[model samples]
Each structure stands twice: as structure tokens, then as C-alpha cells.
Target: MIFLFRIGFLEVSWVDIIDIALVSVLLYQVYKLIRGSIAVNIFLGILALYLVYLIVRAAQMELLATILGQFMGVGVLAMIILFQPEIRKFLLVIGRGTEFRENLFKSIAQWRNSYHEDVNVNEIMEAVKTLKATRTGALIVFSRDVELKFYVETGDVLDATVSKRLLLSIFNKNSPLHDGAVIIYKGKIKAARCVLPVSENDHLPPHFGLRHRSAIGMSENTATLVMVVSEETGRVILARNGIYLRGLKLKQIEQKIVEYLQNTEPANWEEISEEEPTTTEN
Candidate 1:
């Protein structure tokens, strides 16, 4: 049997292809806006309730259908109330786009140059190595997308160049700023002793300490890179995009830093250390 090809429709309507493509793009954007957010769950719940209402109507259950129909009538208002935060966030993003268009491209180009600069990574690596060797506790947060200004304001504003000496001094055990995190932005230190939200995830390993927990919490909210050096064990841990890598060696940590700063996927940090003798403790 000869299959009738869609070439017949293609001859008549190129408009259909454009219409489908536009719809697909809109759906994808909508998904991107709502995915990994509370709105997605709320949307699914509403869909389920609507399905139940349809079933009730089909079954001719008048009382149930009437009740469901009433609820459905007010569902739009309920949804807006339930999703106020997400709706506000979406609107804020749209508003920012107008402002971002004025300066974003230039800023992105500048960031690109900084990412390729060897001085930045070298300075950071030296700091990490020294901090690890001395068993100095430190939390370093690299910001992305979400602004850390609120937390940055909580700490001393450094606005200084990123260098080994500065980083070392800031996190030195005896330093006044040793307790909190240092926020890094655009190849420089933005703030010192910045407080970070601690992760309350029940599934996190019990052995993970405060620094790791805080790093994970910050990562869960933003696409930021966080590095933590344990005071007790000197174990270097990395948290990014809600995943944690523990017991990273100096080299592995540097690689991860470069990868993250350059917007590339970090290599397997734990695997990178496998060639050497694994130390149970830092």
C-alpha cells in the first residue's frame, strides 16, 4: 500500500509549519518559566481537579458537578493568590529585561575576558591551597543570575582585586572576618564575611558540616559556584547547581572553579583524585 505523504499539505500550507513552530516556542518558554518552581506543582494539581470535575459531570452526579463548577469558576482567582510569588518573580524578570538590554551585552563581554584571564584563577588557586594547608575554614560564593547584594550588604564590602594575599588575610583563623563567606564577582571579591543560608535538606549526609550546608543552600537558589574548606578536616568541598563534590584536592578544586567560571561543566572532581592515594581525612 502506498502511503499518502504530508507533501500534499506542504504544497497547500507553509503557514501551518510557522504556526506550529510559534506554538512550540511559546510552550517551551512557558515551561522554562515554570519548571523547577512551585507553580508547576500548582498547575498539575489544578489539572487533576479539572479532570475530576469532568468525570463528575460525565457521571451525571449533579451535586458534585455543581460544587466543582463553582470552585472552577473561582479557580482563576485562587490560582493567582496561590502563585503570587511566582507571578511576581516572572513579572520582575520581564521588567529586568528592559533594563538588561541597555547594558547586558557589554557586561557579558567583559565577563568573558575575565573568565579567560589566568591571573584570576591563579590567585584563587593559591588562596584555596594555602587555606587548605592551614586548615582555615572559609566559604567562597561565586554569584550568577541571582544577585547576592542583600547578603553582600551584611558583610564588609571589599570591592578589591582577587588575590591570594587578600583572600588569605580575610579568612585567616584569627581574622575578624573569618566566620562568614566571601562573595566573588567578576574576578574580584565583592564582599567578605557574607552570611549564607544554610541548607535544611533532610537527605544531606549527616557528616556534612555548616560550610557545606550553606554552600548547598546558596547553590539551590542560584547557579553559583561555592567552595568550602573544612576547619576540622581541611577537606575541600564544592557545591554548585544543587550538587556537592567532597574531598576535592587542590588541583581538582581549581579545575572546577575554572569550569564553573567559564560556564562549562565541571569535570568529575572526585574521579580526578582517584589516581593518587585517597586520604580518608583531609
Candidate 2:
């Protein structure tokens, strides 16, 4: 191997440079995927501990090295458990990217945007408008690509047609099924009062509550759109890709929903981001 440069007594080679560059790129991509979540801090803590372990080993502190070494031995499994959601999302993105061109046409359901005519989205917006006007808290999930059967099973299954009256009644303050989320898939209300995973983002605004956290969490774990209507303020907010879009009018929200169903990535959200800083679970 040829040394390209020297840092004191240490030699640097092109091969080493290439290896470092690739690792850095990988780390950057991982950071991008997990940055807004609490996983970033956990990842940093693990990295710091590993660096300390290396230093302890170099210093010949066998007692400390042995302790950290034991942890390092099972680090891979620990990371897999801790970062299960993030890992799944990363891999999903990679897999989708690789096969996107090949599967673009054959997968009819993936083109769920086509369901626009069938989904009766008008009823949802009307229901949300009423909910907002009444200051009633509501959590609604729209999933076109995936059935979200697991979360759907968490609540009472209605499997009824999409309609404003049904949505309004289900989310009514006194309704038994108003406590959790309502999942709409394939133009039907599959379930009501469904529980969703809560997010672990600690930097959320003080005003955000459990509903907002759940919305963020569900988006983090699945390719779904979550709409949260604030009980306190009657504010309408949307969650997708673990990012929140706040203060959107019904028209904008409808547009975004259509875009999301079409499998389009959010291009610009800076305006709403300025309105609220963005959830928490342990």
C-alpha cells in the first residue's frame, strides 16, 4: 500500500481516504434519517461510549476495557433493538429506490393516489372542519399504500363507508370511540379509537400533546398521513414522514393529502416550520 500523506508518524493512503469517505457518507445518511427523533441523542451516546472504550483499551485499563468490551460485544444487537424503526425506514427507502423504476407500473396499490375518486376525501375535510370549529380533539390517519391493520386492530373495527356524518359522530366528544385514532383506508373507516405509537422527540413545542406525539410516532414508523386536531386550540396539523406541517387550511391540507397519496415527497415546509418548532415517548 502506498502512503499518500503523513500526519506526524501516521501514514494516510488513498484506500484509507476512500474508506473514510464512504463511512462518513453512510453516517451522514443515517443522521439525516434519524436527526429529528430522540434516536439522534441515543446514537451519539452509543458512539461516545464506543470512543471511550477504544481510549480505555489504548490506555491498557483492563478493568474498564473489559467492562466496555463486554458491552461492545453485543452492541450490534443493542443497536438493532434500539433503532429498529429507523433501521426499517432506512432499508425501506433503499429498497424502494432500487426497485422504483421496475415496480412503478405493476404495483397498482402503490398508485393509491388513483383512489382519489374512491376515497371520498371531501367527507374527511368536512368532518375536520367541523371538529376544528367545535374545538374537539381528533386524530385521523389516512393510509393508502399500507392497511395499517395492526393499529387498526387496536380499536373497534367499523369497516364502513367514508362519510362526513360517520366521521363527525365517531369523533364526537361523548362517543366511546372518540378516545383514539380513526383509520381510513381504501375509502372506508376501518377502525375507530385505534392506538398509535407515540414519538420520542423531546424538542416539541410546549403546547403539543399526546395526540400530536402519536401522530408523529405513527408517521415515523409507517408511510402514512396523520391529521391531528387540537382540543385546546382547534388547530389543524398534519404529520408525515415524522415531520409536522402546522396551520394549514383545509384546502392546503387536502392538497397535501393528495400529494402524499401520490407518493410525492414534501418539497418545502419552511413557512409552517417557522410557526411551530417540532413529540415525546421513552
Candidate 3:
């Protein structure tokens, strides 16, 4: 390595600068991935502890340093276990390439729109509108490019057709299936009362309830669209890929759903009504 400068006893070289720059970039990316989540707090706490350990050791505090050194020895493994989900997500992005994943989902959406022809966007919109008016809390998950069987098994399997009346009845406060989430795939309700993972992102609005947190978590883990209706505020929210869109109107919700499911603009209700119904079973 070519020496660039000398700071007292330390020699700084071109390779050292490049190495430091690469490390800084890697740390920044990791910070971005864990920001707004509980993991970031944990990460900072660990970092602070490590700094304390170093200070104590330099001060010749042998007893405290010995204990802290033991913990620091396993720090790499501990971090791996602590940030497993974030690490997996980071690896997934690197392996698949963000553009490739987006294009793949778009192609799938286009194919589903052309062949399935059974989503009944009008019914879904009507159901959501009615739920919004009634201030009924609801969580609807639309699966795409990911298999949600693990989460689906956490609830009651319905395997029923999607209809406004069915959706309304299921979400009715008095209904047994009113709690948890309703999973929809291939334009059918595959499960009800499905317990979805809750997000650990502390930056989510304080007003967001468990339903919204679960929606965000599910979207964060899978390539899925989640819809949330607030019971207290009568607001409609959409979540996808860990991002949330709040205060959506009926038309806006419809447009978002269409774009997510079909990668196209909202379709005419008349044409949707003309299409034949499609059915499937789990």
C-alpha cells in the first residue's frame, strides 16, 4: 500500500482510506435498513456498551473489563441473532436486485389481471366504503409473489368467494371472524382471523393500532398489499413493502389496489361486471 500521510506513529495509506470509505458506506446502509425500528435502538445500546467496555479497559478496571470483554467476544453472533430479519431482507435485496423484483411483480400482476378476471374490484370497493362509513376496523391482505401459508395457517381457512356481503358479514362486529385479518389470494378469501406479524418500527404513528402494525409487518416480510380501516377515525390506509399510505378515499383506494394487483389504471365497473366469475379451493 502507498503511504499517503503519517499521523504521529500511525501511517495512513491510500488502501486504508478506501477501506474506511467502504466500511462507512456499509455502516450507513445498515443504519438505513434498521432505522425507525426497535433494532436500531438495540444496535445503539450495544454500541454504547462496547464503547464503555473500551473506556473501562483503558482505565485498568480489570474486573468490569473482564466481564464486558467476555460479552464482546460473542458480539458478532449476538448481532446476527438480533438483526436476523433485517439481515435476511438485506440479503434478499442484494440477491434478487430491486429492479428485478419490481419487474417480476409487475409481470405477475399483469398476468393475474388478464386471466383471473374474478377480483370483483367493485365489490371490494363497496365493502371497504361500507366499512369506512361504519367505522369498522378491518385488515385485508392481498398476497402477491409470496406464499403466505404460514400466516394463513394461524387463522381459520375459509376458501370462500369474495363478495361484498361476505366481506361485510365477516367484518361485522358481532361476527366470530371479525378479529385479526382476512387473507385474499386469487380473488378469493383464503382465510379469516389470521394473525399477522406486528411491526417493530417505532416511527409508525402513535395513533396506529395493532391492525395497522400487523399490516405493515406483513407487507415488510412479503410482496403483498395490505389495507387497513381505522375504527376510530374512519380512515382508509394502504401498506405495501413496509410503506404506508393513509387517508385514502374510495376512488384512491381502488386505484391503488388496481395498480398493485394489475399494474394498470382502475378498470370500468361495467366491464368488471361483464366478466365471468372464477372460483378456487385451498
Candidate 4:
């Protein structure tokens, strides 16, 4: 290797600098993905062990290096098993932001999108208000860019118009469809009684029930804004991209939903949410 400079007997090259930069970038990306979750501790432990392995190998400690080397051999598979959720999220974020996806979306846009009128945000707010008033637990997912067909197929398809009465009826406690979620896409009620993935986040407050967990989980895995009406406290919660704003005023929630449907949310939403505490209605 071409040496740039030396410290005692060690030399560093441009190639080594470039390699370290790339590895640092990759590790930083991984850290960003799992920063607030439980997996962060596991990731740090693994990183510390790997650093020790490198140190041992560099010092020519044969026995310790050999043992650590064995662990490194299976590191790829171990990381896959341990960080499955984070890996999936990383891949999904990549897929969503890729030029291929953008081009694909443009091409697909040419084939569909004939609907002219927009879904009334006020109507949804009204439905949510009624649900809250009745203390009926409900989960509603709204998507503007990506149609959540995968999760939609998990329950009954409605393809009905968005209305206050319809939402109220579907979420009526005695109604058979009340047990699951409702998905609204492109100004229409795309589906009802949809099943959503439940979040395993340990940091979530215990007061959050299954409905809240499912809403958070759904938002975490997809490009969707989820609203939850608590059956216990009759409070409203909004989740998007893994961050939540719980117990906000109905008007505030309505405004956020409107922004979401308009695809006008501020960039790096999770970052903003992390820096600001949730505001509750007085």
C-alpha cells in the first residue's frame, strides 16, 4: 500500500482513509436506524466486541483473536437474526427513496389517478370526534403516495366513499368490522377491518393498548399516517414514521392529517418529533 505518513512503524494510505470513511458512513446509517429502539443496546454491545476483536488481531494476540475471529465469521448471520426489524426498515427506506421507485411511481401515475375531488378532511375529523365521544377504539391509516395494498388485503375491502357515518358504523363496538383497522387512500375508504402489525417497542407507555400499538407499528413499517382513538381514555393519538403525538386537540390532529394527506409534512418528521414533546389538549 502507498503510505501517506507514518507513526513510528505504522503507515496510513489514501486507500485506508477512503475505506474508513465508507465504513463510518455505513455504521452511522445503521445507528440512525436503530437509535431509539431496544436494539441499540444490542448493536452497541456487538460493535464493542467487534472493536475488541480488531484490537486483538492488530496486537497479534493469537488465542483471543482466534476466538473473536470465530465470532466474526458468523457475524453477518447473527446480525441478520438479531436486527431483522431494523434491516427490513433500512431496506424499505432505501427502496422508497431510490430513483427506481421514483421512476416506477411516475410511470404508474400515468396509468391511474382519475379521481378528481379530494376526501374531505373535515368529515374524517368529525368521524374521529364521534368515535372519541363514544369511547370507541379505532385505528385509521391514511396514505397519499403509496397505496397500502399489502395491509388492505389483510381485511375486507370497502372501496367506499369517505364519510362520517360510514366510519362511525364500521367502528361501532357491536359491528363485526369494529375489531380491526380502517384504511383510507386517495380520498376514499379503501378498506375496513384491516389487520396491522403490532409494535414491540418497549419504550411505549403501558397505557397504550393494542389499538395504539397497531397504529404505531403500521406507521413504523410503511409510509402511512395512522390515527388512533383510545377506547379507555377517549384520547386521540397520531403516529407517522415511528414517532407519535398523543392526546392532541381534535383541531390540531385534524390539521396534521390535512398536512399529511396533502403531502406537505415538514422534512425529517421523526427528528422534529423527537425534539418536541407531545402537546395535549387543555
Off by over 4 Å in 4: 1-117, 268-282
- Higher TM-score: candidate 1 or 2? 1
Query: Which residue pairs clash in candidate 4?
Result: none
Expressed as tens digits, the lDDT of each residue in 149-224 for candidate 3 is 5578899999888899999999999999999999988888899999988988888877878998998887776667
How far off is model 2, as Cα RMSD?
9.6
Minimum summed lDDT over a 10-residue window in model 4 is located at 273-282
Q: Candidate 1's residue-wise lDDT over 32-96, tens digit each?
A: 45543446767899999999999999999999999999999999899899878557755654577
Provide the RMSD of all predictions against the true structure, rounded to 1 decimal: 8.2, 9.6, 13.0, 9.1
Quote the lDDT for 17 in model 4.
93
Ranking by TM-score: 4, 1, 2, 3
Over 4 Å off in model 1, which ranges? 1-119, 144-147, 266-282
Evaluate residue 274 in candidate 1 and report its C-alpha lDDT on the 0 to 100 scale. Answer: 39
What tens digits encode model 4's per-residue C-alpha lDDT throughout 84-139? 98898667656766633553444445535533346788889889888888898999
Instruction: Kindly report the root-mean-square deviation of model 1 from the true structure over all alpha carbons.
Output: 8.2
Give the per-residue lDDT of model 2 (tens digit) for 165-242: 999899888999999999988788899999999987887777778999999888876768889999999988888767
lDDT score, residue 273, model 2? 25
